[model samples]
Target: MEVGFLGLGIMGKAMSMNLLKNGFKVTVWNRTLSKCNELVAHGASIGKTPAEVINKCKVTIAMLSDPAAALSVVLDKDGVLEQICGGKGYIDMSTVDPETSCKINEAITSKGGQFLEAPVSGSKQPAETGQLVILAAGDKALYEAAIPAFDILGKKSFFLGQVGNGAKMKLVVNMIMGSMMNAFSEGLTLADRSGLNPRDLLDVLDLGAIANPMFKGKGPAMLQNNYSPAFPLKHQQKDMRLALALGDENSVPMPVAAASNEAFKKARSMGLGDMDFSAVFETLKVLKHSS
Candidate 1:
């Protein structure tokens, strides 16, 4: 099937590449058009504008960085709305607030396009291997229609009933992930400060109930202070902020998530925003305290 893809950031590029490798015809667009070169070399077409891609493909999927980018690509001049019409499907796989997903859904549906919000779980390695878990909602038909592509992009996909559900699920998942990372950082710092090897601590954690992919995947790299961007710190902080807002709207107190957001903010303040979210480890590591 022919597909249109937007936002060629880390996740976007990998996803679009997977489609190309799977023999799907994909037309892509990005704000910095030069980012399209890599995909073009892999046998993908380029669209001069978001509208152009939508006009040329029946299914257009976007994996933008944030809600603003997601909205701009669809609402700005020469955007998706200009070409979206009946029989066209638009799926936004960006991590955003439920409200943002709702806004995009309304706009697309108003223009006779099918809309789906499908934010994924997992980072760079998962994205590259198509092992991410997708949380999808809005337009069940569209979700079903996009399954073939989703199958290639993610190992699993869920249909969560409404437009905002997928976004909410994604935020909640990321919030918990941020909180866990914060706690994990504290453990590592405490272990090292107390003369215990952090590597030993990771091994212990890996043998226990909390053993999971994230800690195992990030622990060693973080120990070497490898802050390469997979899912960037700034984006994690943005998800935390958006998740906290969702909590506020529902009158729920998210103390852990709020604290995690603060840690992420501190890391960003240290110019670690472009680093991986695990770079928040630097914040805890650098804190001056007496034992």
Candidate 2:
């Protein structure tokens, strides 16, 4: 099937490449034109605008950076909504807030276009390997119709019943992930200050029931103090804020998540937002010194 893919950032680029490798005829666009050059080399067509992509393909998948960028491409003048027609499908794979996704859904469906929120759970590596888990929400018929495209992009796709649920699920997952990462940082720092080798502590943790992919993957980087961005701190902070808002709406107390959100905020204030979320370690270091 032919597909239009937009927003060729680190994760988005890997995802679009997977679609092309799976032999789908792919048309791609990015705000920065250079991001699409590699895909163009792999026989993917490049579009100059979101309208161009929607007009050219049956399905348009967006993996933009944030809710603002997603809305800019879909609701701006000559945006996807303007170009979408009946029977066309739009799948947004960005990690946006539920309210934003619902607004986009309303706009798409009102224009006679099918819409699905399919926010993903893995980062660039998983997207590169086509092993990302997709949390999808919208019409079941459209979910089934887009299954092939979903399969090409990810190992599994879950139909979560309505437009906003997928975005909600993403916020929930990221909230837990952010908190876990912060806890790991605190433990590692404590081990170091107590004269235990941090590496050994990581190895022991890896063997324990508390072990997780985040700990295993990010531990080595923490050991070496490398904070390159797989997932940026600002984005993690954004997700945490959204999750806390979700909790507030439901009258649920999320003390752990609230604390984690402050940790991320402190990290951002330290100018670590452009770095990996692991840079939360730096904030923990300052807190440790203060205490």
Best by lDDT: 1
- Report the C-alpha lDDT of model 2 over 1-291, residue by residue, as the tens digit: 899999988788998999899889999999888889999999999999999999999999999888899899999976898899898999999999999999999999999999999999998778899899999999677788889988977888899998899999999999999999889899998998999999998899899998878888989988888998888899999999999999999999999999999999999999999899999999878877899
TM-score of 2: 0.97
Model 1 residue 108 CA deviation (Å) reads: 0.7
- The C-alpha stretches of model 2 lying farther than 4 A from their native spots are 288-291
Q: Report lDDT (CA) for all predictions.
A: 0.95, 0.91
Model 1, residue 170: what's the lDDT? 92
Alpha-carbon deviation at 238 in model 2, angstroms = 0.6
Candidate 1: C-alpha lDDT? 0.95
Kindly list the per-residue Cα lDDT of model 1 for residues 1-291, writing each as its tens digit. Answer: 999999999999999999999999999999999999999999999999999999999999999999999999999999999999999999999999998999999999998999999999988888899999999999999999999999999999999998899999999999999999999999999899899999999999999999998899899999998988999999999999999999999999989999999999999999999999999999876784422
